[model samples]
Target: MMDMQTQPVRSQSRPVVEHGFVTESMTDTCAIVANLEHCTNTAVALQSHYAQGFLSSRHKHGRGQISYCQSGMMLVMTDEGTIIVPPGHFIWIPPNMYHQAQAQDGMCMLSIYVENGLWPDLPGNSEVFHASDLFECLMQRMIEIEEKGAFSSSTFDAIVTLIRDEIGLASRLDMSMPMPRDRRLARICNAILREPTVLRGKDELARIGNVSHRTMTRLFQTELKMTYSEWCQQALILNALARLAAGDPVTTVAMDLGYVSPSAFSAMFRRRVGCSPKEFAKQY
Candidate 1:
């Protein structure tokens, strides 16, 4: 992904609405929208956030949101699942759907929040849509409009309608992670999250959860719907992707992430991400 710290800034127009807040320059690769108030259906606010590390908060927007990164990668988590947004790939979040997004590398994002009732055909709540050619262009246009602060007669409505239609027709891609609420299982989850690439075996997690191996297995399958090892793999892959995006070298990342060797990590990367680490790095 291109560095946000060096991306061209939007025009000098200041925000007219007191309700919308913007973080003009977040980093060399990202921006942030702290919050926006009273910004309802007809109008949506666009902002950006860039970070080199993870963002831990799970969010539920009052309206729908689309986060398209100009650079780097984003992993968005929701109750339903987690979606990986690579550069040129974005995620569409329906209204009221809880989600948390973490930066894999340093990321530059353009996020738009729409009113709840604007589009009916689209999923009522969370749906992750792959970024299509038209979809990507529309997002770029939105940036141009917002930066110029030039709202014409049909500007807002036209843009919203196009986005709504795109949402209606856009393919729903699998880019989500399911979250379990069980506190016992959650303990194991927390441990894995803290050291995703290093943790090993169900016994380790069972010890931390203070449960038998059998119990831990049952809880992991029943609550998380995946084995402990599988969950750990998923977590490690996500962490690896983030680290890779942040411009880390493969050999160093492999070592730091607990791989036995760079080749071992490369194989895992290819298996999970459908590409070698070097190939994936080129997309950013």
Candidate 2:
């Protein structure tokens, strides 16, 4: 999981400090620590407006990336799987991993790129991390530093070290929505994904691809290693998480997602997320 701290922010073109020592409890007393003259080991950047419908061509970087979105969501697609990063979550991408990004709405993002040898014990694959309050604060502070092209400082190194340690032991969630590359299965999968709540069941869904229900079911199992029902469940849950992040009421979201009743949806949500939908939505 990701984590965050802080208070009223002090606005300024450049962060100025009294003694250059930072505090976690009060933002007025804190400054977005200036960066290092040379961040060769961990280059950082920020995208304040990941605009609606944002899309990136497939690409790879030589450095590992740690990305956090303080608002909205990010969809990442790679050979291994597809990852959904909603508000209050973070995403990590290993160096040289070919991937593309899609955003349905605007997002505020902070990305730190670590030189290969400086990655430490972080995972080698992309991870969608649940951002904690502490990490949220840190990301904001980090972003402030990255915005200016020339704000380097010694304390910046210390901050990077803390970020590395925090990620090493943070909680992990099985939040990926893996997809098959097969043309036929991909077509059906995309249809259901467009409107996750309107699925007509496996038997009828097979018609989208002009295939027999049995064949479609087998194809899902073989290519994605997940049954059709399992895939649907995964899609629905991902949609629910996004809606909750947008501040939708639990009851309304449940009903809109086609749950028979709020209680039934709550049970499934709790089983899958280990918390009530109400509790989950409060993260933002």
Candidate 3:
């Protein structure tokens, strides 16, 4: 029988910070912090205070990555929109495509970069998924191996296989932000995303997009099937979800997003997400 005392416990907190953003020709931040040539599909790295957003690299490797913010958060903003990664949550960024990440707060990040081709059927793009209890345990165990330099043994191989299998069968990644395909509308969408909680008026955003307020409203309706206000509300909801995942108190997030009171925020979240912020926090 597996000994409970020997089991790895999920870390309760982390200290990672946000990275800014990167372009297509750039390399991953992993290469800068760790020895990439020595990095392996089975090897993993644990880091704290990861505060910079790495640029997007279009490189597609057979290697897949599992990144966890045990305490802080990461925003995996891809061409496909963003995936908010908070403590107890991990993001799977498949090989290739343009992808980048930003941390919301200080972070304790453990990255398991893999090469088993195990997650082919998963989303063709980046996604955030809740890490299972076993998967979280496996991640911590891998960190142990790294700290102890145990990668030379077959024990490490066993761990790798286990992780790959978990990825294959782990729950489907349920959280994602699908990108709008239209170039004109996508520009406006991206602007909102950069500063979701900010009270930037539509007329201001319209000017940023080099279009009139009327034109912007029409594009959102005719092309995206949502009104300008509706799209903005969705952006705020998504932003709130990220903030909540980062362990921010409901009162704080509500106020930061310009809500006058916690009850108002609760009402908005309930209306959009079908649950209160407290309930949503409990689910993750």
Q: Top model by TM-score, which number?
A: 2
Error of 1 at 91 (Å): 2.1
Q: Backbone collision count in every prediction?
A: 21, 14, 16
List TM-scores for all candidates, in order.
0.72, 0.76, 0.65
Off by over 4 Å in 3: 1-49, 52-61, 151-153, 168-187, 194-207, 212-230, 241-249, 255-284
* lDDT tens per residue, model 3, 1-284: 01112211223342221211111112244443334334443444444344333322333444566777676656666776656665667888776545666655445666665544555665666766666788778877866655555455467677767876777765544455555777777787887877887788777888887888888888887776667777777777777876786568999999988889999999988765556899767744
Best-fitting candidate, scored by lDDT: 2
- Candidate 1 residue-wise lDDT, 1-284, digit = tens: 12213333233444334223233444222222234334433546465655565464555656667777778787676776566777766677887676666666567777677666665555654555656678777867766765676656477577667866776676665444455688887787777776776747778778988989999889878987887777777777767776777677999889987888999999988766656898767776
Candidate 3 at residue 188, lDDT? Answer: 79
lDDT per residue for candidate 2 within 215-256, as digits (tens), equals 998999999999888888889988898788778898998999
lDDT (0-100) at residue 153 of candidate 3? 48
